[model samples]
Target: MYLTAVASLRAGHADDVFLLKRPGWVRDTLKQLDEAKRLSGGELFVARWMSGVVRAQVPGLFGERAAAMQDLVWCLAHADKAPNLGWMREVYFHLAALHRQRGEDAAARRYQTLSGFASETRPATFTTPFSEAPVAGHTFSSRLIREVVPGAVYLLSGFEFTEYYFVVSADRRELIAIDAGTRADAARAAHEALRARVPSLPPLTTVLVTHAHWDHVGGQRYFRSLSPSPRFIGRGNYKDELAHDAMANPAGLQLFFGKEFQLADVLSYKPDVTVDRPTELIIRGTRFELLPTRGGETDDACR
Candidate 1:
């Protein structure tokens, strides 16, 4: 019956995507679908995945916000028809994306773990290595800090979560780094790289964080380890963001796998410089204007 209904719908439309806000659509239709139809077919699975994602992702895209995921949940309840999305990794990625849209990183990572991948790691490879895996198409290295702008802007792909940035003065006498990644390793590597390639490149006087998310500030402590200990700067809401993280930090370990340490050892960052309102500063001939943003990915995204 599922295929029959989909076929009827597809007969008129050239496209495959359909957006039905009603959860009853899938439940009622699937309930009447011919039992002989194979639910495991890839096309059907894609249709179901779209249905699940739309429902699971939106907070109030529909008039009813609370029951958004109800249809998707119903589909998941069908033990047999449901796709092997659990360990297959594909559906797991979509579910993770939906959860992230809901601002539930922990919840997303929980689903991600069942698929044998944890974002807390490098590229979130499987924890339980079920099948002989091939070389990952994607690899991440945080320590390699490369200059995006000659003698000026630099970026360090710090970790799976955090990426750091550096801005140097025209004279190469003063510099500021931004957003240290998730741990001390990235910080140490970034400093070592800078020291090796451009030993004469300015002293890091300030380090600015774009937001208060753990991935943005987790490795902040290690910035103090750099020469002269650059001051950490964040928006005025920085304290509130930190307070929020401090409350949620404990649960983070359970959400995403903690790399190389126990949950109790995980630490959140504290900012040194706070800019309230739009503020402009001229330090060592470099002008910086700090502005706060309400939300892009987090509640405290700043510019």
Candidate 2:
């Protein structure tokens, strides 16, 4: 099962893995393993293997980066099970890349070599084009620019992810919530702050997710559950990638948000609004033009 799961992940059939899990495979497996433990003298490693098989197929389906990352770490940390060396190598190489981006050359090199992802196979070694900092904790509105367009445009820079864009109509009634802070706590805090600043503004009619990483989408669940729930939007391809990452890793809770948060914590909120192609929407009178972009951080992004 573990090997099958790995093949599915590499083959890009992550959705199937989640379908099996939604029915409660993990809980069922745990029960069976508990019975096995009672009958046998020792805890069996087979249970671990079975779980990894299902997990390795799509680690990121948990819909959060911290969750995806922790799962990747768990897979690598487990030595006793009949592990998937390739999956371990891929995750380690990815971690090495993350470390190099953060300027941890020593740690980067360590992971690269340990995973057998040598410098020769790829382009330059230790080249992380993205920011290394743990994504900035704060954000502010960019200078307002009066353009030919119908609505006002605001730039959001110095963020943990790429810059953010928030557009509001000339009339204060219509409003749309753009990117929130990265990490669940940061995102949640930012949303609350935005609310406190503008007390009379209408409820958020729409939320546009630029991409589907934790930093970008962490507050999405929180925002979606508001009283007059806002319509959430994302590139159409967004869900599959997010889902794949969650199932394969299932470690996002630990790696990104810290270990206290877990899968059960995130399932409470899933994306209610998803869009495949670049689209536009008018929320409470404010209009937004969402353009899709692809780059170093995610396969699909909204600009």
Candidate 3:
């Protein structure tokens, strides 16, 4: 029911005054989220966070600033309990915007700084091993490398916008990279950094991409240049998805990837192996089950 309301709200453009002004839609949506919270076993933090976001949005369109500020403040007080850095950052950014709307410059600046700090520290705090995870809202501005599963799996965070992972085979003879990252330079630097940090790590023999998104496959060319070029793997619909994105938003490519991003690089990336259905792959001794699934972000996704 909560998901249904969210979908409806999204379809109706929840921010539009027409939907917010509808007799009981917004109010009932909040009520449903409240019920969802009650039945969430104290684990669904997103429900509470969504409610706060809706309340924050109501003020500008409906002139309910006082009530919205109260809910936003409550969310701020409990921001530490947010499920991830992205959620925590949104709460801070919302508060900053609300304070700015109310003419509270100092308060707005404080939350803005907190939001930037959250963005800077996100890669490290969430990707590190569970036992060694950093405190919430910790501030740092450098890349981080951590062993997620001791000797078998490791994480390379903070090199680029997306996090990359390296997995070792059971016999420790082969290494596989999870994603290529956003740019060749960034990917090359991350790969070199990992090898430098773990000199005994095995040669990278395979590169598996979760999807055909620009950020995930941009570094394919670099990986292809290795001594024994690693075999690339991606979803069967990879090319179709890339073509769709290229036709739909060709102009926006450089906005996120910078002016230097080349569309030809992304369009030319091809996986040596493509999985359209459930497939089992054994790299050296480590086994991986590849499942292609559709998601809100992209239909050509593999897990």
Candidate 4:
């Protein structure tokens, strides 16, 4: 019965993974798990473990649906079951944000205080291509552009010194892009550079987004609309980050870019493959292990 309940929740397709995050489903699932736990008697450990997993994941799995899903009572009931304070940090932050959004200053402050880290201590500035420092340990100058060996990959530079890569396959039959430039001009420059130098390159087959920051994803739509549109690969919370940064109704674009911000270009695209933790990828026989970071440039970033 426990296995049956778990199997029912498995994602059968890309859409199911992101679409089935409603609170009603969670409530129903929890009820079923609790029943299974009761029925299992002495062998209830598996059901108990699964229940704990759902409790911890429910906060994030619902992402932008926080207003309806962030039930403090539910969390308090399972406080003892929480893995650790560090694991609960994001949950605390989200609760704080939700309270703050609703004008409950006292409640907001309470949740913020509960968060393990001081929010103000984080740097407001990020080291981008515009910074004198190297990006991911690769340096570039006004005249120098970034390049990777063997297959001859090109990294175009622009906005916050935004750098996007154009990866050519080992057999030159496919192109794999990484991030689009910050804006139209930057994307145009990258596109033009590709046309002028790598004209023979084939259609893009895949795009791996390092994070959901504006500088990294601004040009994604431009690339996605192109012929032979590529499938996106990113972390599971990638959509939530997109919602937070660009599309979360009021607090997203309105707060950052202002009310004048155009909603047309901003999109919350689903990743074809979502990684919950460090995972390996093989692109055209090339193996790459994606590792999660404590967030170097942004909280959603992976190294």
How does candidate 2 fare on TM-score? 0.41
* lDDT winner: 3
| Cα displacement (Å) at residue 151, model 1 | 1.3
lDDT of 4 by residue, 249-276 (tens): 5434334333333344445456787777
Tens-digit per-residue lDDT, 1-303, candidate 3: 466357337524655657436636666665665566667653455665665666666536555556556656766676555544455665676677788888899988898787775431233323222221111111132367789999888888766556779999999999999978766766787899989988998999999999988888877778988999999999988977788657746446555554445566677889998899999999888999999999768999999
Query: Relative to the true structure, how large is the alpha-carbon lDDT of every model?
Result: 0.55, 0.50, 0.71, 0.56
Mark the regions of model 4 whose C-alpha exceeds 4 Å error after superposition. 1-146, 247-264
Backbone clashes, candidate 4 = 2
Per the 3 Å backbone cut-off, how many clashing residue pairs does candidate 3 have? 0
Pick the winner on lDDT between candidates 2 and 3: 3
The alpha-carbon RMSD values of the candidates against the true structure, listed in the order shown, are: 16.2, 21.9, 11.4, 20.1
Lowest lDDT 10-residue stretch of candidate 1: 129-138
Residue 152 alpha-carbon offset, candidate 4, angstroms:
2.1
> Regarding TM-score, does 1 or 4 come out ahead?
1
What tens digits encode model 1's per-residue C-alpha lDDT throughout 57-151?
A: 33353443233344344445552443333323544555565566679989788766754655633364332312211211111431355779877
Worst 10 residues of 4 by lDDT: 130-139
